[model samples]
Target: MQIKANNPDEYIAQIPEDRIPYFKKLRQTILDNIPKGFEEQMSYGMIGYVVPKSLYPDGYHCDTNLPLPFTNIASQKNFIALYHSGIYASPEILDWFVAEYPKHCKRKLDMGKSCIRFKKAEEIPFDLIAELMQKLTVKNWIKIYEQTIKK
Candidate 1:
């Protein structure tokens, strides 16, 4: 579940031992695909990727001192959650993910506007996840974020 931790390593360490490698693989995939200018940290009791304040001084609209959140991966009680702001902000990307998900995954995509939930590690559509991670850069996300706030 939402085990609060002081940092990313601590947050990851809180994962169930048996599930460590599974989460690690997901984490590594995100790391490999994440564009430059994003930083990884512990945010909202989960592992988060964000656009640092150094690059965007306005920071997150919710809290000006905090970075703009891009995505997050969390180990939950019944499932693991992957949250991506890009998919939530862009209908085209969301549609693309929905249409392509079945091609790569056997399970139904348990999802919300931004959060994709996986009941088991095998249920994760990693290729799609990686592709989505790669698609959103800091500059692109900032543009989307600004548009969203305006709306």
Candidate 2:
């Protein structure tokens, strides 16, 4: 579905009727576990929660303004996507997710970076997903971000 959200609120409102429930649940999951020093906004036509440059001015890649640690949630044509930089930055977290939630094997997890896709709401491991979300909050993300910046 097409999302015409120019801002975060509009983005949340623009979610297609069919995908509203899933989107809402996912949105709430992220909001409920939001970390400190992070700002929520709309980026790449999706709902993105980011760690501002002030906290890590050089957080982005290639000197870009994009924040190093963030999560992006989007409503795709056939599925919903939840993107988190945390997974790619923390092997321990990613490994635990893959090991504890093999049921998600059918789901598309873009480990290449940090995007995880689910074709349906039922496909998502809500509890596990929330756990990861909490672990990846701005505070924890900074620690990982620092390690990454050094390398």
Candidate 3:
């Protein structure tokens, strides 16, 4: 679902009430695990963690006015979606996550290039996600982005 919100709080408030606790926990997990320098804000209609302009002055290449998005979380119609640019940009991280997913989650991973979809709240693997969050620091992400995604 597309939620139009000014901030992360507003975004979570619009998600299904029943999933509030889970989303809150998931959000907290990211906040606690993601490396320092990534700022939380409303990004692309979801809760996002980004490298602020102060760190990467160029910001997102697609839009210089915005920060460089590192990750995002959103409550979709059928699942909770996590978008991690690191996995998309770094093959090593993707391979690590792919190999480790089965150990943490019973369901086969439902994923796209960068989006990990958890169809049920109980199926989400917070611990694995936390580890994934720590794999990429702001400097590492920017370096990867510049080398691979920025063009």
Listed in order, each prediction's TM-score against the native is 0.95, 0.80, 0.98
Stretches of candidate 1 exceeding 4 Å from the true structure: none
Instruction: Report lDDT (Cα) of residue 151, candidate 1.
Output: 35
Task: Report, for all candidates in order, the number of backbone clashes.
Answer: 0, 0, 0
The most accurate candidate by lDDT is 3
Clashing pairs in 1: none
Which of 2 and 3 is the better model by TM-score? 3
Off by over 4 Å in 2: 103-112, 149-151
lDDT of 3 at 22: 90
After superposition on all CA atoms, what RMSD does each candidate show versus the true structure? 1.1, 2.9, 0.6
Candidate 2's error at 91, in angstroms?
1.0
Model 3 spans > 4 angstroms off? none
Residue 116 lDDT in model 3?
Answer: 96
**In model 2, how many backbone clashes occur?**
0
Task: Report the CA-based lDDT of candidate 1 relative to the real structure.
Answer: 0.88
Model 3: worst 10 consecutive residues (lDDT sum): 116-125
Q: Give the TM-score of candidate 1.
A: 0.95
**Lowest-sum lDDT 10-residue window in model 2:** 103-112
Q: Considering only N, C-alpha and C atoms within 3 Å, which residue pairs clash in candidate 3?
A: none
